[model samples]
Target: MQPAVVAHRGASAHAAEHTLAAYDLAIAQGADALECDVRLTRDGHLVCVHDRRVDRTTNAKGVVSTLSLAELSLLDYGGEIGVLTLDALLGLAADHGVPLFVETKHPVRYGGQVEARLVELLATRGLARPSTKEESPVVVMSFSTLAVRRVRALAPRLPTVLLLTQLWPTLRDGTLPPWADHTGPSVAMLRRDPEYVARAADHGHATYTWTVDDPADVELCAGIGVRWLATNAPAATRATLAR
Candidate 1:
């Protein structure tokens, strides 16, 4: 089977990352899944923003947790797009019938409240747990083992992905943390150790390689039997893999 094409921060290469416009473009491009980074504002509203501070992606400064949702709405992302709420993003995904890969941003002021609130939000939408894999449309991912574990505790049926930036002792064998249902590795890590993919598969773990915008990297991932390919260029990646 062809690997599922997951859009990283929507079709971010063509539009502002995490904006509704980007997500709409990703759906139109036929991405199998949409990925987003989740952060909590000071007033406890979950938002779809990648950076700790809005300065990088928006026209404002200061940490996400230091600003209220209303305060965040005043800033412009990429000068034209406004900040997107997690709730609004979910609605867009639901409307398009595309699955969501939610990445919980780390070092937030909220201790474990991020996961808790995420679970609550999904539960409210009747999406926290699904009776079958096809029925589930959301997956929680994080670089923090603790964060993923928290998701497992609160929403047992929700799939959890452990994102890897660098090889750690616990994951040297291509196994994930106990609570993680899948593994997400950076493209560089997979390129550095091609065998890691097979090792992970041997351990019954599904490997998803991220931010693969290059054609060669896409070929490498397809050759390694990765189950998911997260990329900014989903249309091109899907076409290349189809061949």
Candidate 2:
């Protein structure tokens, strides 16, 4: 099977990251899915953002949960890039016939607001129904297991992927790391230990790795049978996988 090419934060290379323009461009470039990082606004609205503070990505300074949606809307989320809300993103994905893989950025800080709102949004978009396979494709993912679990509880049919990094610790005595307790399994660990991937698959979860920029790394992930590949250079990653 062809590996699914997920545009990291949309076609972030060409357009402003996470903006409608970037997402549209990603679809135009033949991406299988679009990836987004979600955070909660002060007023409980879910917005697409990568950082805890908006300074890096937006023309604002402050925590995302501290600002209301109305206030956040005033700031340029893409900075010189373009800004797009979660709703706008989902709509665009639906219209263009692409799937959306949403990653919750700081679930502990935002509580369950992001997952709850995402579930609601997906349901409203008719994506919650398993009967319709092509209306709007969506999958909620996160480094936080709590966030992923919340999404699974709300929408069991929706596939969830666990993002991984190498820094996480192993479970020697059934004791998980502070971050691992919150996140599903680590994709990096999965690469290091095939048993980790087997355990995750046994639990019915898909695995995905993030920010993969190296061509060799992309090929390695494909060889491992990872379901999703989140990369900054989608075109390059896709090319590498094709090889």
Highest-scoring model, TM-score = 1
In terms of lDDT, which candidate is strongest? 1
Please write out the lDDT profile of model 1 over residues 1-243, one tens digit for every residue.
Answer: 668999999999998999888888899999999999999999999999998888899876888999998898888998555579999989999998989999999977897999999999999999987996446899899998899889999988998889998888878887876788788889999999988988898888888889899999999999998988999988899889888
* Count of residue pairs whose backbone atoms collide, per candidate: 0, 2
Return the clash pairs for model 2, or none.
145-182, 145-183
Cα lDDT, model 1, residue 187: 94
Weakest lDDT window of 10 consecutive positions for candidate 1:
74-83
Tens-digit lDDT string for candidate 2 (1-243): 555788999888777787777777788777888999888777777778888888887876888778888887787755443346788888888787788888888644668877888888778877875554233387767776687677777876776665556434454222333322122334455456645544545544445666666776677667766667777677777778777
Residue pairs with backbone overlap in model 1: none
Cα TM-score of candidate 2: 0.81
For model 2, the stretches where C-alpha displacement exceeds 4 angstroms are: 78-82, 132-136, 166-191, 194-205
Alpha carbon lDDT of each predicted model: 0.89, 0.70
